[model samples]
Target: MKTIERRSTCPINYSVEIFGDKWMLLLLRDLMFNGKNSFLEFKASDEKISSAVLTEKLNTLLNEGIVTKITSPKNASKFLYMLTEKGIELVPFMVEFLNWGSRYNPNGGPKTLLEKIEKNKKKAIAELQDNLRSQRHSYTNNPSDAF
Candidate 1:
Protein backbone atom coordinates (compact mmCIF):
# COMPACT_ATOMS: atom_id res chain seq x y z
CA MET A 1 0.00 0.00 0.00
CA LYS A 2 1.21 3.50 -0.73
CA THR A 3 1.39 5.82 2.23
CA ILE A 4 0.05 9.36 2.11
CA GLU A 5 1.22 12.05 4.48
CA ARG A 6 -1.04 12.44 7.48
CA ARG A 7 -2.58 15.76 8.39
CA SER A 8 -2.91 14.64 11.98
CA THR A 9 -2.47 11.59 14.22
CA CYS A 10 -6.20 11.31 14.93
CA PRO A 11 -7.88 8.17 13.66
CA ILE A 12 -10.88 10.14 12.52
CA ASN A 13 -8.63 12.42 10.56
CA TYR A 14 -6.99 9.43 8.94
CA SER A 15 -10.36 7.98 7.99
CA VAL A 16 -11.61 11.27 6.62
CA GLU A 17 -8.50 11.68 4.56
CA ILE A 18 -9.27 8.45 2.77
CA PHE A 19 -13.06 8.58 2.62
CA GLY A 20 -14.05 12.23 2.93
CA ASP A 21 -14.85 12.34 -0.75
CA LYS A 22 -18.38 11.20 -1.55
CA TRP A 23 -17.20 9.52 -4.73
CA MET A 24 -14.90 7.15 -2.84
CA LEU A 25 -17.69 5.96 -0.58
CA LEU A 26 -20.04 5.59 -3.54
CA LEU A 27 -17.46 3.52 -5.35
CA LEU A 28 -17.08 1.35 -2.26
CA ARG A 29 -20.84 1.04 -1.98
CA ASP A 30 -21.06 -0.09 -5.60
CA LEU A 31 -18.33 -2.65 -5.08
CA MET A 32 -19.86 -3.95 -1.86
CA PHE A 33 -23.45 -4.13 -3.02
CA ASN A 34 -23.97 -3.49 -6.72
CA GLY A 35 -21.88 -6.31 -8.28
CA LYS A 36 -19.97 -3.88 -10.47
CA ASN A 37 -16.43 -4.70 -11.60
CA SER A 38 -15.43 -3.34 -14.95
CA PHE A 39 -14.81 0.35 -15.62
CA LEU A 40 -17.73 0.38 -18.02
CA GLU A 41 -19.99 -1.01 -15.32
CA PHE A 42 -18.88 1.68 -12.91
CA LYS A 43 -19.41 4.37 -15.48
CA ALA A 44 -22.94 3.10 -15.93
CA SER A 45 -23.80 3.84 -12.30
CA ASP A 46 -26.80 6.06 -11.70
CA GLU A 47 -24.60 8.81 -10.28
CA LYS A 48 -22.90 8.99 -13.66
CA ILE A 49 -19.32 9.50 -12.67
CA SER A 50 -17.16 10.93 -15.40
CA SER A 51 -14.42 8.81 -16.95
CA ALA A 52 -11.55 10.94 -15.64
CA VAL A 53 -12.84 11.05 -12.06
CA LEU A 54 -13.60 7.34 -12.05
CA THR A 55 -10.12 6.51 -13.25
CA GLU A 56 -8.60 8.78 -10.62
CA LYS A 57 -10.66 7.31 -7.79
CA LEU A 58 -9.99 3.74 -8.88
CA ASN A 59 -6.30 4.49 -9.06
CA THR A 60 -6.40 5.94 -5.57
CA LEU A 61 -8.08 2.77 -4.27
CA LEU A 62 -5.52 0.62 -6.03
CA ASN A 63 -2.69 2.67 -4.54
CA GLU A 64 -4.17 2.28 -1.06
CA GLY A 65 -4.54 -1.49 -1.44
CA ILE A 66 -8.26 -1.22 -0.83
CA VAL A 67 -8.95 -2.63 -4.32
CA THR A 68 -7.25 -4.90 -6.78
CA LYS A 69 -7.45 -5.02 -10.55
CA ILE A 70 -7.33 -8.27 -12.48
CA THR A 71 -7.33 -9.02 -16.17
CA SER A 72 -10.58 -10.56 -17.36
CA PRO A 73 -10.04 -14.09 -18.57
CA LYS A 74 -13.10 -13.93 -20.77
CA ASN A 75 -11.89 -10.79 -22.47
CA ALA A 76 -8.24 -9.91 -22.45
CA SER A 77 -9.02 -6.27 -23.24
CA LYS A 78 -10.99 -5.78 -20.05
CA PHE A 79 -10.30 -5.80 -16.31
CA LEU A 80 -12.22 -6.53 -13.13
CA TYR A 81 -11.97 -4.89 -9.75
CA MET A 82 -12.40 -6.52 -6.35
CA LEU A 83 -11.93 -5.46 -2.77
CA THR A 84 -8.87 -6.62 -0.91
CA GLU A 85 -8.90 -8.06 2.63
CA LYS A 86 -8.24 -4.57 3.90
CA GLY A 87 -11.15 -3.31 1.88
CA ILE A 88 -13.38 -6.12 3.11
CA GLU A 89 -12.77 -4.89 6.63
CA LEU A 90 -14.85 -1.83 5.77
CA VAL A 91 -18.05 -3.84 5.33
CA PRO A 92 -19.38 -3.10 8.79
CA PHE A 93 -18.73 0.57 8.30
CA MET A 94 -20.57 0.48 5.01
CA VAL A 95 -23.53 -1.21 6.67
CA GLU A 96 -23.69 1.44 9.35
CA PHE A 97 -23.47 4.14 6.72
CA LEU A 98 -26.36 2.48 4.93
CA ASN A 99 -28.35 2.29 8.12
CA TRP A 100 -27.63 5.92 8.83
CA GLY A 101 -28.67 6.94 5.36
CA SER A 102 -31.82 4.89 5.56
CA ARG A 103 -32.68 6.68 8.75
CA TYR A 104 -31.79 10.22 7.71
CA ASN A 105 -32.33 10.38 3.96
CA PRO A 106 -35.54 9.80 2.04
CA ASN A 107 -33.98 7.56 -0.59
CA GLY A 108 -30.44 6.97 0.57
CA GLY A 109 -30.34 3.21 0.95
CA PRO A 110 -32.04 -0.04 0.00
CA LYS A 111 -34.93 -0.74 2.31
CA THR A 112 -34.69 -4.53 2.30
CA LEU A 113 -31.03 -4.65 3.26
CA LEU A 114 -31.52 -1.94 5.84
CA GLU A 115 -34.31 -4.01 7.38
CA LYS A 116 -32.01 -7.02 7.49
CA ILE A 117 -29.29 -4.96 9.10
CA GLU A 118 -31.70 -3.62 11.68
CA LYS A 119 -32.99 -7.07 12.49
CA ASN A 120 -29.57 -8.55 13.29
CA LYS A 121 -26.72 -6.17 12.88
CA LYS A 122 -23.88 -8.61 13.53
CA LYS A 123 -25.30 -11.37 11.37
CA ALA A 124 -26.04 -9.01 8.54
CA ILE A 125 -22.54 -7.54 8.63
CA ALA A 126 -20.97 -10.98 8.78
CA GLU A 127 -23.06 -12.19 5.88
CA LEU A 128 -22.02 -9.19 3.79
CA GLN A 129 -18.37 -9.65 4.66
CA ASP A 130 -18.57 -13.34 3.88
CA ASN A 131 -20.24 -12.63 0.57
CA LEU A 132 -17.48 -10.21 -0.39
CA ARG A 133 -14.83 -12.76 0.54
CA SER A 134 -16.53 -15.45 -1.45
CA GLN A 135 -16.75 -13.21 -4.47
CA ARG A 136 -13.12 -12.18 -4.22
CA HIS A 137 -11.89 -15.74 -3.78
CA SER A 138 -14.07 -17.05 -6.57
CA TYR A 139 -12.76 -14.39 -8.88
CA THR A 140 -9.22 -15.17 -7.92
CA ASN A 141 -9.62 -18.91 -8.47
CA ASN A 142 -12.08 -19.21 -11.34
CA PRO A 143 -13.97 -15.98 -12.04
CA SER A 144 -17.04 -17.99 -13.01
CA ASP A 145 -19.08 -14.95 -11.99
CA ALA A 146 -19.58 -12.26 -14.58
CA PHE A 147 -17.04 -9.49 -14.97
Candidate 2:
Protein backbone atom coordinates (compact mmCIF):
# COMPACT_ATOMS: atom_id res chain seq x y z
CA MET A 1 0.00 0.00 0.00
CA LYS A 2 1.12 3.55 -0.62
CA THR A 3 1.51 6.01 2.23
CA ILE A 4 0.76 9.70 1.83
CA GLU A 5 0.21 13.00 3.57
CA ARG A 6 -3.26 14.13 4.50
CA ARG A 7 -4.62 17.67 4.23
CA SER A 8 -6.73 16.78 7.29
CA THR A 9 -8.09 13.67 9.00
CA CYS A 10 -11.65 14.08 7.75
CA PRO A 11 -13.40 11.28 5.85
CA ILE A 12 -13.98 13.65 2.95
CA ASN A 13 -10.26 14.35 2.83
CA TYR A 14 -9.59 10.63 2.59
CA SER A 15 -12.12 10.36 -0.23
CA VAL A 16 -10.43 13.19 -2.05
CA GLU A 17 -7.12 11.50 -1.56
CA ILE A 18 -8.41 8.25 -3.07
CA PHE A 19 -10.68 9.42 -5.92
CA GLY A 20 -10.62 13.17 -6.38
CA ASP A 21 -9.49 13.07 -10.01
CA LYS A 22 -10.97 13.08 -13.50
CA TRP A 23 -9.10 9.97 -14.64
CA MET A 24 -9.95 7.63 -11.71
CA LEU A 25 -13.69 8.30 -11.91
CA LEU A 26 -13.77 7.97 -15.70
CA LEU A 27 -11.84 4.71 -15.63
CA LEU A 28 -14.17 3.42 -12.92
CA ARG A 29 -17.19 4.55 -14.96
CA ASP A 30 -16.08 2.41 -17.88
CA LEU A 31 -15.64 -0.64 -15.68
CA MET A 32 -18.87 -0.14 -13.74
CA PHE A 33 -21.29 0.72 -16.56
CA ASN A 34 -19.69 0.03 -19.92
CA GLY A 35 -18.54 -3.45 -18.78
CA LYS A 36 -15.16 -2.75 -20.33
CA ASN A 37 -12.51 -5.22 -19.18
CA SER A 38 -9.67 -4.97 -21.62
CA PHE A 39 -6.96 -2.35 -21.90
CA LEU A 40 -7.95 -1.56 -25.46
CA GLU A 41 -11.58 -1.01 -24.48
CA PHE A 42 -10.67 1.39 -21.68
CA LYS A 43 -8.32 3.21 -24.03
CA ALA A 44 -11.19 3.56 -26.46
CA SER A 45 -13.25 5.58 -23.96
CA ASP A 46 -14.65 8.95 -25.04
CA GLU A 47 -12.42 10.60 -22.45
CA LYS A 48 -9.43 9.68 -24.63
CA ILE A 49 -7.16 8.63 -21.78
CA SER A 50 -3.48 8.39 -22.60
CA SER A 51 -1.90 4.96 -22.39
CA ALA A 52 0.68 5.91 -19.77
CA VAL A 53 -1.93 7.54 -17.54
CA LEU A 54 -4.26 4.61 -17.94
CA THR A 55 -1.51 2.24 -16.87
CA GLU A 56 -0.81 4.36 -13.81
CA LYS A 57 -4.45 4.61 -12.74
CA LEU A 58 -5.02 0.89 -13.22
CA ASN A 59 -2.02 0.21 -11.03
CA THR A 60 -3.36 2.57 -8.38
CA LEU A 61 -6.72 0.84 -8.28
CA LEU A 62 -5.03 -2.53 -8.16
CA ASN A 63 -2.93 -1.41 -5.24
CA GLU A 64 -6.04 -0.23 -3.42
CA GLY A 65 -7.75 -3.59 -3.99
CA ILE A 66 -10.59 -1.67 -5.66
CA VAL A 67 -9.99 -3.73 -8.83
CA THR A 68 -8.66 -7.15 -9.59
CA LYS A 69 -6.72 -8.39 -12.61
CA ILE A 70 -7.17 -11.85 -14.02
CA THR A 71 -5.24 -13.62 -16.69
CA SER A 72 -7.52 -14.20 -19.65
CA PRO A 73 -8.39 -17.89 -19.87
CA LYS A 74 -8.76 -17.72 -23.63
CA ASN A 75 -5.70 -15.60 -24.26
CA ALA A 76 -2.61 -15.93 -22.11
CA SER A 77 -1.31 -12.57 -23.23
CA LYS A 78 -4.41 -10.62 -22.19
CA PHE A 79 -5.70 -9.56 -18.78
CA LEU A 80 -9.19 -8.63 -17.60
CA TYR A 81 -9.97 -5.96 -15.04
CA MET A 82 -13.06 -5.88 -12.86
CA LEU A 83 -14.25 -4.11 -9.76
CA THR A 84 -13.99 -5.71 -6.33
CA GLU A 85 -16.55 -5.35 -3.55
CA LYS A 86 -14.98 -2.07 -2.47
CA GLY A 87 -15.30 -0.62 -5.92
CA ILE A 88 -18.87 -1.81 -6.42
CA GLU A 89 -19.78 0.05 -3.23
CA LEU A 90 -19.19 3.31 -5.03
CA VAL A 91 -22.28 3.08 -7.23
CA PRO A 92 -24.34 5.50 -5.18
CA PHE A 93 -21.55 8.05 -5.16
CA MET A 94 -21.27 7.76 -8.90
CA VAL A 95 -25.02 8.28 -9.24
CA GLU A 96 -24.77 11.50 -7.27
CA PHE A 97 -21.88 12.49 -9.45
CA LEU A 98 -24.04 11.78 -12.45
CA ASN A 99 -26.82 13.86 -10.98
CA TRP A 100 -24.50 16.79 -10.34
CA GLY A 101 -22.89 16.69 -13.77
CA SER A 102 -26.18 16.19 -15.50
CA ARG A 103 -27.54 19.23 -13.75
CA TYR A 104 -24.68 21.37 -15.02
CA ASN A 105 -23.70 19.72 -18.29
CA PRO A 106 -26.32 19.97 -21.02
CA ASN A 107 -24.78 17.19 -23.11
CA GLY A 108 -24.86 14.58 -20.36
CA GLY A 109 -26.56 11.40 -21.53
CA PRO A 110 -29.47 9.59 -19.84
CA LYS A 111 -31.39 12.75 -19.05
CA THR A 112 -34.67 10.99 -18.26
CA LEU A 113 -33.04 8.48 -15.95
CA LEU A 114 -31.19 11.21 -14.17
CA GLU A 115 -34.38 13.19 -13.65
CA LYS A 116 -36.06 10.15 -12.09
CA ILE A 117 -33.08 9.58 -9.82
CA GLU A 118 -33.03 13.24 -8.88
CA LYS A 119 -36.62 13.03 -7.75
CA ASN A 120 -36.10 9.82 -5.77
CA LYS A 121 -32.44 9.76 -4.90
CA LYS A 122 -32.65 7.13 -2.19
CA LYS A 123 -34.75 4.73 -4.22
CA ALA A 124 -32.57 5.23 -7.27
CA ILE A 125 -29.44 4.54 -5.28
CA ALA A 126 -30.87 1.41 -3.70
CA GLU A 127 -32.04 0.08 -7.04
CA LEU A 128 -28.67 0.70 -8.66
CA GLN A 129 -26.78 -0.97 -5.81
CA ASP A 130 -29.08 -3.95 -5.97
CA ASN A 131 -28.64 -4.14 -9.73
CA LEU A 132 -24.88 -4.12 -9.39
CA ARG A 133 -25.00 -6.80 -6.71
CA SER A 134 -27.05 -9.06 -8.95
CA GLN A 135 -24.67 -8.60 -11.86
CA ARG A 136 -21.49 -9.38 -9.92
CA HIS A 137 -20.92 -13.09 -9.48
CA SER A 138 -18.34 -12.58 -6.76
CA TYR A 139 -20.90 -10.93 -4.53
CA THR A 140 -21.82 -14.02 -2.50
CA ASN A 141 -23.46 -11.76 0.08
CA ASN A 142 -25.64 -8.76 -0.62
CA PRO A 143 -23.79 -5.53 0.11
CA SER A 144 -26.94 -3.86 1.34
CA ASP A 145 -27.23 -6.66 3.87
CA ALA A 146 -24.22 -5.20 5.60
CA PHE A 147 -25.93 -1.89 6.31
Superposed on all Cα atoms, model 2 deviates from the true structure by an RMSD in Å of: 5.5
Question: Which residue runs does candidate 2 get wrong by more than 4 Å?
Answer: 1-8, 112-120, 138-147
Looking at model 1, which ten-residue stretch has the lowest summed lDDT? 138-147
lDDT value, candidate 1, whole model: 0.88
Q: List runs of model 1 lying over 4 Å from the truth.
A: 1-3, 144-147
lDDT of 2 at 108: 83
Candidate 2, residues 39-138, lDDT tens digits: the string is: 9999999889999999988988888888888665556698878677798889878887887887789788586667769789888877766665554544
What is the TM-score of each predicted model, taking all chains together? Answer: 0.91, 0.77
Q: State the displacement of the C-alpha of residue 78, model 1, in Å, after optimal TM-score superposition.
A: 0.8
lDDT of 1 at 12: 99
